[model samples]
Target: MAVWSLWSLLLWEALLPPEVTHAQVQGQVGGHALLVANRPSSFQVREAIWRSLWPAEELLATFFRGSLETLYHSRFLGRAQLHSNLSLELRPLEPGDSGNFSVLLVDTAGRAWTQTLQLKVYDAVPRPVVQVFIAVSGDAQAPKTCQVFLSCWAPNISDITYSWRREGTVDLGIEPSGLFTDGPALRVSLGPEDKSVAYSCIVSNPVSWDLATVTPWESCHREAGPGRASYKDVLLVVLPVLLLLILAGVSAWHLGPCSGKKKKDVCADEVAPEAENPLV
Candidate 1:
């Protein structure tokens, strides 16, 4: 019985494909994943086979000489392709399609080479929404700069990270502990210099990223402080008045009483008209 068992083990080992280190590949839903075989082009190949082993071991495709064959009734039938170079292509990938895939390349001399890969699929992340609000610092009566809280959120995502930046500048590098809430938010004190800058929030996961931006003038609503006026607000109120004043000055210079003809000619014409009436 022991001799028979040993023989069976040897047979099983002989049938198994050669072992190689596995590699990881990442893909998104509605995309494609390619598994490349590293076989040397100079090596003559008689046949090749591709299989999947996770969830269950199943034959995926086979290549004989110059011809290719895919499993007719398999779930991957219409979406899998075997290339002449012993590479496999899976298209229109779904989340459930991620798992282990293996390729076995058989040389014309009856020797086989094999490799395995692990695939991971993720859903694309959507754009994040950012909200900003003012939070008073210390006591309300204490003359302190107001703190602004920025909240960033995305739906139906996990394992996400948040980053902040002042637009057109370097990253804000806000620490996680500086957030007002415990999650994806940031707390910052608004300095006089910050009023003219725009802040952006970036949210990301392993697969994708998104951004949202807010300007300090538009996002934070407050009564103008004693001597503080937003540059944007000042421009909005001052620019139109300045334009109107310029227009009025140009009109007066072009159309006023002294604009056309000489004053001496008018006086001479009035005196000549009186002399022509000459009853005195």
Candidate 2:
């Protein structure tokens, strides 16, 4: 048994690619991941056991005499299968499925071979939010144009990339001055002609991508002149003040001292004649 194990180890070393052992395999959520054994086509497998090593070492699936055994764990039931190539397939993978996978294969000659693989599963990124900033030129006489800065963002994600598309095209060779591309943002000065063009921001990771679109007119508004106010906005503010002034004038007119008639003075008759008659 020892000699056969040593021989199987040597065979694996010769057949396995170097990258398969060194790099971690990435899988998308709700997708499938394959753990390859890289066994030679000529080799006949007698038995195999696929196991997980992280969170806890647990048996995932098993094969005996070229047939799958009845001892699959509940977590992998209906979702795991062993292929003829000695590869294990896990379907509908989830974020919690990320871990180390190990496979032990025994050949027809009772030779034991084992391999371990690292798997990482990630959730699909959400649709990105695009924010726009407009910087107006100080000079009024200059063309009625402004610098537009666009930023794309996705929350709670890492290892993401950002790309910008203008009018469904990727080329920006003819961009105007002040145009710049940063990590997740694009800054450009837009003239009148560019206002009608559509822009899109794409955010992606290894597993998934999301996109957001906007037009220059939607993000940027024409600069308002000094003291400029829309008629609706002016009416909204002025109507309330005018109503209050009219109410004040009406109240004052009703409550003021001059609103009521003045009272008349009364004169009493002299009582001296009455007093003299009583003395007599």
* Per-residue lDDT of model 2, residues 1-280, tens digit only: 5336435544664575422233367889999988887665565777666778886787777666556642556577778887776688889998788888877676776555667789998888889998888764566636656677888898888778888777644355676433324468887677666767777788888889998888866455534433566456689999999999999999987776444344111111244456568544
Give the lDDT of residue 271 in candidate 2: 43
What C-alpha lDDT does candidate 2 achieve relative to the native structure? Answer: 0.70
Task: List the RMSD of every prediction in angstroms.
Answer: 12.1, 8.5
TM-score of 2: 0.65
- Assess candidate 1 and give its TM-score to the true structure: 0.65
lDDT of each: 0.72, 0.70
TM-score against truth, every candidate:
0.65, 0.65
